[model samples]
Target: MAELRRENQKTTSELKETQKRLRQLTQTIRELEEENSILRAQALKLKEDTANRDLSFSRELQQMKEQLQEKSCHVSLSSYTHATVPTPTLSPAAKPPTPPDPGNSPIPQPSPTSPTLTPRDSPSDTHSLPAAQPLNTEPNPDRPAKPEAQVVLLMDSNGKYLDTKRLFPGLITRAKRCQNRGQAMELLRQDTLGNPQHIVVHTGTNDLHTLHRETAEAMTKMAKRASREFPDSRVVISTLLPRTDTPPHVIHEINMEISRSCAALPNIHLAHHTNIGTWDLHDGLHLNKVGVRAFAKTLKDVTLDRNPNSLAHTAAPPRNYRPPRYQQERQSNTASHLPAAPRPPAACYTLPSCPTQPQKTPPPSPMDDLRLCDEQSHPSPTH
Candidate 1:
C-alpha cells in the first residue's frame, strides 16, 4: 500500500511539471506572434515609404524637366525678339538728295548774295529749280547684268526629287513640272520668264512605256524649240533614265536617236546618266535618295559645263567601260597558273564633233582565253 502511494505521488508531480512547461511555451508563442505582427507592419510602412519617395522624386524630376524646357523656350523667344528688330523706313522727304552725276554739265552757280532763297520763298524761285528729267525706261548697257537663273523641268515631281538650289547656292533654281514632252513644250512656251543661263530638261522618263519613237522625236523637237527660244542659254537635254519596267535596249534606241538629232546643234548638249542602274531606283521607276543625289550632282555638272570630256555619247562600251566580272572568272577557271589577261584601256565618251583618239590595245595575256567567251557573248559592231 505504501509503495503504491509513492508511485501515485511521483506520477502527479510529472503531470504538474508537463502542464507548467506547456503554459510557458504558449506564452512564448504569443510573444513571437506579436513581434511578427509588429515586424510585418514595419515592413509594410517601409514599402509605402519607398513607393512615395520614388513617386515624389519622379514628380520633382518631371517638374525640373518642364522648367528647363520653359527656360529654353523663353531664351529662344528672347533671342529671336532681340535679333529681328524692325528696320525704320525713311519717307521721301527724309531721303537724302541724289548725288549729281559727273557726266552731266554743271549748272551756272548763282551769286552768293542772290537772296539765299529758301524753298518757302516763292513760286518764282521754283522756276529756278532744274526741270525733273523723265525717268529712263531703257536698260543701261553700262550696268553689270544680273546673274541668269537656271531652270529645271521635271515630268511629275515638280523637281522635288532633287534640290539643285540647295546643292548649288549660286544658282537660282526655277522648278517646273510637266506631264510629257508635249506638255513640257507648252509649258516652256507659256513661260514668259526671261532666258535662263541653263535650261535642264529632265522629262521623258514618264513617257517611256507609252511612246517609244515618238518620245524621242518629241524630245528632239522640244530641244530644238528650247534652243530657239533660249538662244543665249545652253539647252541641256537629259537622256531618258533607265527604268526596270522598260527594256534597256528600247531606252538605248531612244537615247541614240536623240543623240543623233541633237548632235548637229552646237548649243545643245546631252547630260548622260548612263551610270545609273536599277539599284539606284526605288519601286523600279522613281529615284530614291541615292539616285536623287546623283541626279542633282549631274545636273550641277551639266549646268556648270564641267567635265566636257565625260559626256557619254555612245550607248555601248568604251566610255566608263568596266570589264565584266565573268571575264575574271573565266580567266581563273581556264588558267590558274598563268597571269590574268591585260584589261582594255579605259575611254571617255566624246561627241562626234570631238572624237577621242583611239587607244592602243595591250598585248593579250594568257587570260585572253576569256576573250573567246566574251566575243561569243558580245560580238563587235560592224561599221
Candidate 2:
C-alpha cells in the first residue's frame, strides 16, 4: 500500500507541472496575437500616409507645370518679336539722340511733322557710315573688326529679380509671372519674339509644394520644344531645388524624378551645384543669393564659351554688301548733275492715237481658287 501511494504522489507532481507549462504557453500565445495586431495597425497607418503624400505631391506638380507653361509662352512671344524687329545701325558722325531712359517715365512718340533728317546730315551723329571704297581704306590693315556680344536674361516671376541684378546689371528684366500653363505658354511666345540666345530656367519649386505631375510634363515638353524652336539658343534646365524640411523619402523621390526628367531631354543641360548634398532653399522653393550668383556665373561662362565662332560671324559684314555712305554720295552727286525727275502730266482730254484690240483676260483656274473654308472641311481622320 505504501509503495502504491508513493507512485501516485509522483504522478500527481508530474501532472501539476505539465498543467502549469500548458498555461504559460497559452499566455505566451495571447501576447503574440496582441503584438501581431499592433503591427498590422501600424502597417495600415503607414499605407494611408503614403497615399496622402502621393496625392499631395501630384497636386503640387500639376500647379508647377501650369506655371512653367505660362512662362514659356510669354518667352516665345518675346523671342519672336526680337527676331522680327529691325535693328538700326548707328553712324559715328550722326549719332542718334540719347533718348531718355524709358524706365523713369513713358517714352514719347515723335510727331509726323518733326524735322525730317537724312542719315548723313543728322547733327547728333558722331560716326560716319562705312564707305563703299576699297578695303584699303582701313587705317590698320592687319586688324580685324572686334566682335561685340550682349547678355540677356530669361526668367519667370519668382527668381527673375536675381537674374536682373546679377547677370544684367545695366538692363531691366521684364518678369512674367508663370501662374499656369497658359501663362507659361505666353511667356514662351514672348521669349521667342525676343530671341534670347541663352535661357536659364529656374522653376519646379511651386510644383513640389502643390504636388502637380503636369508641371513636370509641361516643363519637360517646354525644354524639348525650346531645343527645336531656338536651335541656336542653349537651354539650361536647373535641377529641382532641395527642400530639407520634407521627409527624406519624399525629397529623394521628387529629386529623382526631376533628375530623370532632365536626363531624358537631349538638349536640356543640368546645372551643377558645388555641394550636391547640401539642400539650398528659400521658402522651400527659390534659391538664396549665393545660389543665384553661382548659377548666374556658371551660365555666363557656359554661354561665353559655347559660341566662339559667333564673334567672327557677327563682326564682319557680308562680302557682297556695299557701304551706305557710297550709295548716299552717289545718289547726291547724280541728283546735283541731272535735271529734276519729271512730274506726271495732268489728265487732258485727247483722242486715242490708234484703236487697240482688247486683250482676252485669262479665267481663274480651279487650282488658283482653292482656299481653306472651314475646320470641318479638312477634318483629320482619327487614328
Best by lDDT: 1
lDDT of 1 at 333: 81
Q: State each model's C-alpha RMSD to the native.
A: 25.1, 36.2
lDDT of each: 0.73, 0.58
Q: Which stretches of candidate 2 lie over 4 Å from their true place?
A: 1-152, 156-158, 161-182, 190-192, 213-215, 248-252, 262-266, 272-282, 301-383
TM-score of 1: 0.42
Residue-wise C-alpha lDDT for candidate 1, range 1-383, written one tens digit per residue: 99999999999999999999999999999999999999999999999999999999999999999999999998777555444333444556655556576568497556777776676975764554445555444445565665546664444552576665586686676777776776777766525546777777778888776776688888888889888887888778888887766766788899999999999886888887876665666676777786787677677788787874546543343354443444446667889778878776555444357767999998888678798888989999999
**For candidate 1, which ten residues in a row score worst on lDDT?**
314-323
Residue pairs in candidate 1 whose N, alpha carbon or C atoms collide under 3 angstroms = none
Q: Write the per-residue lDDT of candidate 2 for residues 202-230, one digit (tens) a residue.
A: 56555655655455666666666666665
Top TM-score hit: 1
> What TM-score, over all chains together, does every model reach?
0.42, 0.34
lDDT for 49 (candidate 1): 100
TM-score for predicted model 2 compared with the true structure: 0.34
Cα-lDDT of candidate 2: 0.58
